[model samples]
Target: GLAERKKVTHVAMESTGVYWKPVYNLLEAEPIEVLVVNAQHIKAVPGRKTDVKDAEWIADLLRHGLLKGSYIPHRAQRELRELVRYRR
Candidate 1:
């Protein structure tokens, strides 16, 4: 399935709560460029609150290079996250 998906050059996601780890991991494992953006940075205006449209908006911004990428640890650092979480 992963081979089917086109090679991703970058990833953009709205930074919500602490629920972004897995999402980050999935993308990071592919070794593609990743970006985590602030939700407020991409908040939609009135009458444009649909999920589909919101995703489209994010994609649009990413395409035009308007999205700001957040920090993602290197593979070693990411491994530490697993150890920290599992040990808890």
Candidate 2:
């Protein structure tokens, strides 16, 4: 619940293809801040490829406030961009 996360500050999410959009929109609706970072930026060194470990790494980076979020345009701007893209 959003209420339960009142004390929670920042939430970090890896920037996959386009899966992070809905999640970002939902969280943005709340007061909580959402950070979308490049997957390469948060990935561990070579030979450390595990889902659990990847999640842990992201969490650790987010907890320490080390990850920086990429720019996200306003919804209206996004819609306009989409319209232009489809028309092209």
Candidate 3:
């Protein structure tokens, strides 16, 4: 959209266990900020999930800084972590 034509300033993703790695990799550089919230933290009215409402819920939380962000390792640290973890 025209309104978002510029580079994205921040990104928000819901953490589903360890399933967020690929997403983090994709957005690590472009966006100046990245926020990964835990799925357990979001609460909605009792009903079936809808794409529109789900996006709204996540957006609302993100706007208010109410969503907790996941820890992202520094680049050097991340490389070291992967090396150690793989050696095990």
Candidate 4:
């Protein structure tokens, strides 16, 4: 994986609806720490609004440990919730 090749220790991404789930699930199995940050928090910071710029901004903040990750339940809990939802 690119992360292993680059020796990346942490990854941070904006939380946008249900889109971050699959990616998070994949990264959860990796050795690196994954942070799902609120988009609003990123927007709150004054910066240029471009995809490239936003990525760099997020990376910079993550590198400095300035970003806060949202609470994500464990895989078992998440799967149980999904099953319940499907049953409902």
Which candidate leads in lDDT?
A: 4
lDDT of each: 0.80, 0.83, 0.74, 0.92
lDDT of 3: 0.74
The sequence of per-residue lDDT tens digits that candidate 4 reaches over residues 1-88 is 7689899899999999999999999999888999999999998767577989999999999989899999999999999999999999
Stretches of model 1 off by over 4 angstroms after superposition: 1-4, 78-88
1 against 2, candidate with superior lDDT? 2
The Cα RMSD of model 4 versus the native structure comes to 1.4
The collision pairs in model 2 are none
Given candidate 4, what's the lDDT at residue 59?
A: 98
Superior by lDDT: candidate 1 or candidate 4: 4
Give the root-mean-square deviation of each candidate in angstroms. Answer: 2.8, 2.0, 3.3, 1.4
Q: Which pairs clash inside model 3?
A: none
> After best superposition, candidate 1 residue 15: deviation in angstroms?
0.9
TM-score, cand. 2 vs. native: 0.82
TM-score of each: 0.74, 0.82, 0.71, 0.89
Runs in model 2 deviating more than 4 A are: 1-6
- Candidate order by decreasing TM-score: 4, 2, 1, 3
Give the residue spans of candidate 3 off by over 4 A: 1-7, 43-45, 48-52
lDDT of 1 by residue, 1-88 (tens): 3523876677788889867778886777675667888888899456676889988888999999998877767878878988999999
Report residue 51 deviation for candidate 1 (angstroms).
Answer: 1.4
* Model 4: residue 51 alpha-carbon error in angstroms: 1.8
